[model samples]
Target: MTDRLKDFIENNADGFNDLEPSQDSWNKIAARIGHSEKVRNKKLRYISIVSAACIAGIAAFIIFFGKPQNQTDNFAEIPEVLEAEAYYTSQINMKKEQVYQMAGNFPELKNEMEVDLAELDTIMVELKKDLNDNVSNSEVVEAMIQNYRMKLMILEEIKSFLETKTDDQKNTTSYEL
Candidate 1:
């Protein structure tokens, strides 16, 4: 059987060679394969582009609109700043309380003090944001301390003014008596 098959192939080899496919047929097959490949490549390119755009959009969203990290964690690392902030905060609260008590008869003065303190509070908030954005900005921390000092100074001055006014009233009453 093997000898017969070999003999048949030898006899028909020339005929098989003579019946080769046309060049046009080869070109058509090549063109079809090439076109399919091009379509596949285009689909792949579009998928990759869309995927990249989605990744970039997600990254931007997380950067711009994500929940803010706790700022106290950053401040915790700076013990001196924390101590100063606590100290100044306590002092400021005490002084503000004293000023409020003394300025009961002076609503205008209280309002003025609130306006000034509010401005300082706004500045302090901006400084805190700056500090959060840049974890350890010494200048911003110093500015925050200075802002506290200014608030304390304003309260002290108002308290002194009220004290003098009270003393003057007392002296006038004594002289009248």
Candidate 2:
């Protein structure tokens, strides 16, 4: 039994030696696989870094320059209208004599005022048309503003007159009472 054990040990020892790879060969194979894995990892890392950098750069560009430029460009393209000025001027130019003549008499003056208001409505429609046609023109924008301003002024004047008339009526009524 001992001799058989010794023979088995000696045979298996040489068998294991034959099966074992040389140290240098094993090292080369290990190094090749390791190097390949390292290269793959490096390439992946580089791609990831480049992608991140590209995204960051685009974001930075949009944040720093794109949004404000777009806003300014949009605003710049919109025509400026001086509505208040136009309304005021138009109101001042309204002919009181014409209004009175249209009234036919004192009682009819209210009707005349209404008719005059209709004229203003016509003027507003024309101004809106002009604005639509010449939206790109600065002069047109200014004219529209002036026209609107005049209209507003006319409205204010009418409002004042109505208030005055109302006050007068209240005073007369109180005196009669």
* lDDT by residue (tens digit), candidate 2, 1-177: 379978888878866576756669966785777644345435434443443344344333433443222122232235333444444555544644444433342454355345544554455454444444443334334444544444444445444544555667669967995
lDDT of each: 0.67, 0.47
- For model 2, the local distance difference test gives 0.47
* lDDT of prediction 1: 0.67
- Candidate 2: segments with Cα more than 4 A from true spot: 1-107
Lowest summed lDDT window (length 10), candidate 1:
51-60
Point to the candidate with the largest lDDT.
1
Candidate 1 per-residue lDDT over residues 57-131, each given as its tens digit: 433444455455545556535889889989999999999998888888878667767867776676666667666
TM-scores for every candidate against the unseen true structure: 0.56, 0.34
